[model samples]
Target: MDAALADCRACPRLVAWREQVAREKRAAYRDETYWGRPVTGLGPADARLLVVGLAPAAHGGNRTGRMFTGDRSGDVLFAAMYAVGLTNQPTATHRGDGLRLLDTRVTAPVHCAPPDNKPTPDERDRCRHWLVTELGLLAPTVRAIVVLGGWGWQALLPALTSAGWQVPRPRPKFGHGVRYEIAPDGPGRSSLHLFGCYHVSQQNTFTGRLTPAMLEDVFAQAKSAAER
Candidate 1:
C-alpha cells in the first residue's frame, strides 16, 4: 500500500486536481486541510476479504491520511465491521486509533483524492498494477471481495479475470449484493468471490442512497463467504 501510495503518478489530471483541491479551501471546509497526498489504506495482512472503493474524498480520507479512516464513509464502514466482529476499534478517526481489521481489508482503485470525487480511467488503469500485486499477495487466503461501486469493480475485474476468476453470464453487472466466485486456481483453496455494493461515500449515505443495512448486508455476505 505504501509503495502504491508513493509511486502513484498515474493520472496527470488527478495529480493536478489534487493540487487544486489542496490549494483552495471551500467555505464549508474552513477548518479542514485537504490531504491531497496519497492516502494509506488499512487491512489485515492475512485478511480473507478485500473491499475496494473508488477513491479518497477531498476532505475525508484524503484529509485524514488514512484510507476510509476519517470520513463519513469510515463511520459507516467501521460501524459495519464492528457489527460483524471484523473490527476491534468501534471507530477509526485517526491512523493511531488502535483500530485493527479482522477478516476484511479495504483498498481503493487510486491512492490519491480525485477532485469532484472522480477518478480518470487512466488513473484507475495505472493503479491496477498495484492492485494486481496486492491481489497476488492476498489471494492465498482471500475468499471474496466487496467492490463499492461500478468503477471499482471495473478497475478490479481485469486482475481477477487474469487470475482466472469467472464472471457469471447473463452477467452480474455492478450493483449491491451481486457475487461472483473466481475459479479455483489449483488444488489448494482456489475460489475467490467478488461482491458488489454501492460506494459508501458521503454522497450515497448523506443522500440516503445507502444505509447501515445496505452496508451491513454486503459484509454479511462477505462473512458468509469467508466462513464457507
Candidate 2:
C-alpha cells in the first residue's frame, strides 16, 4: 500500500504543486533533498488510534516523507501525544528521527501537498481512495479516530460510512473536543469513536486557539476510548 501510495499521480494539480515546491526548495532546507511525493500513512498496522489531518505541509511531510514530520504543526501534535503517552518523543524533526507512536497511526485525507496549504474538494475526493483503503485495512484494530480540523473531519465521515461504520443520519458537527460514537454494522466488527480537535497549525497554535493542554485533553479521550 505504501509503495502504491508513493507512486500515485491521480491528481494533476496536486502533483504539479508538490513537485514545484520540491524543485524550488525552502531556503532553510535548500541543501536537503525533498520527498515531494505522496506521504504515506505511518505507525503500527494494528493501531487502535487513528489520527487524520488535512494534508501534508509543503515543507513538512512533503519534504520529509512522513506524515506531520518536519513542521511546527507536528511539534505541537507530537508534544501533546507524548504527554498523553502516545509517542516516544515530543518532536518530529525528520522521517528517520526515531520517533514512534504507540497504539496510534497518523494519516491525511490528501496524500500530496497542496498549494497555499489547501486542497480543492475535487482533489480531496480523488485522494479519498487511499484513506479509505487505509481505514479498511486498520478497521479491526482501530477503535477511535482523532480528526484534526474540520477538513479532516469532513473527509473521514464518507470514508467511515463507506467502510461499513454506521454513521448517524443528521451527521455530527465538527468542533474542538467534540466526540461521537458510531456502532459497528454487525457482529465481529469494532465500533468506532470519533474525536475532533483543532488542527495543530501555526494559525491556531500561535494565537492560542489550540493549546498544549487542549490537545492533551483530546488525546486523553482518544487513549481512553482506544483502551476500552
Candidate 3:
C-alpha cells in the first residue's frame, strides 16, 4: 500500500490537476512539501475503529499528507477526536506534525486528489480495490468503522455484502451516530460494527449544518461502540 501511494500514477487527470493546483496555490504551501501526490492511508496499520473519509481536499490532504489536516474540516474532526480520546494530538496542521492516533485509524476511498473534489465513477471503481485490500488487512482487528459520509458507505457495501453479511436494508442511510451491525460471514468471526456521520466539510460546519456538540456526540458514540 505504501509503495502504491508513494508511486501513484493511477489517475493522470488527477495528477495533472494536482500539479496545477500546486503551481497556482504555490504560496499557500510554499514551506510544505505539497503532498500533491497521492495520500496513502495514515495512522496505525493495525488499529481498530477505522475512519473512512471521502477524499482529500486540494489544500487539506493535498497540502499536508496527513488525512484531515490543514483545512476547516480537519480542524473540526480532530478536535472531536481529541475530546473522545481517539487521538493523541489535538491539532493536525501538517505532515510530521507529531499527530498520533490512539485507537483509531483513517483512510479514504480515493487515495489521490481528484479533479474538483469529485472523482468519476470509474476513478472511484479503480480506487476501491485499495479499500478492499485495506479492509481485509484491518478487518480482523477492527471493532468498529466510522464512515464519514454517504459515498463512503456505498463504496464499502459490496465488500461487506459479499462476505455474507446483510449490509443494511435500504443500506444504513447516512446520519450522525447511526449504527448497524455487519453480521459475520463465518460462524464464529466477529461482526463489523458500522457508524455514520457527516464528512465534517467546511460547508457542513459553516452552514450551521453540524455543530461542535453534534459532532462530539457522534464521536462519543463511536468510541463507546468501539469498546463494546
Q: Point to the candidate with the largest lDDT.
A: 2
Candidate 1 regions exceeding 4 Å error are 23-35, 168-171, 185-189
Instruction: Please provide, for model 1 over 1-228, each residue's C-alpha lDDT reduced to its tens digit, 9 standing for 90 to 100.
Output: 565466566678877777677768567666776767776557877788888888888767766677888777889888987897888877988767798888777888788888678777877777776776677667678888889988888787786655545554555688888877667544434687778998887788999898998888888888888868
lDDT against the true structure, per candidate, is: 0.77, 0.93, 0.79
TM-score of 1: 0.87
* Model 3 spans with C-alpha error above 4 angstroms: 162-169, 186-189
For residues 82-175, what per-residue lDDT tens digits would candidate 2 score against the true structure?
9999999899998778999999999999999999999999999999888888988898899999999999999999988877788898989999
Q: What would the per-residue lDDT of candidate 3 be over residues 38-97, giving only the tens digit for each residue?
A: 787887877778888888888888877778888989999999999889988789988778
Total clashes for model 3: 0
Alpha-carbon error at 201 in model 2, in Å?
0.8
Best of the two (1, 3) by lDDT: 3
Clash number for each model: 0, 0, 0
Predicted structure 2: clash tally: 0
| Candidate 1 total steric clashes | 0
Which parts of model 2 have CA positions greater than 4 angstroms off?
Answer: 186-188
Model 3 global lDDT (CA atoms, 0 to 1): 0.79
Question: Roughly what TM-score does model 3 have, to 2 decimal places?
Answer: 0.92
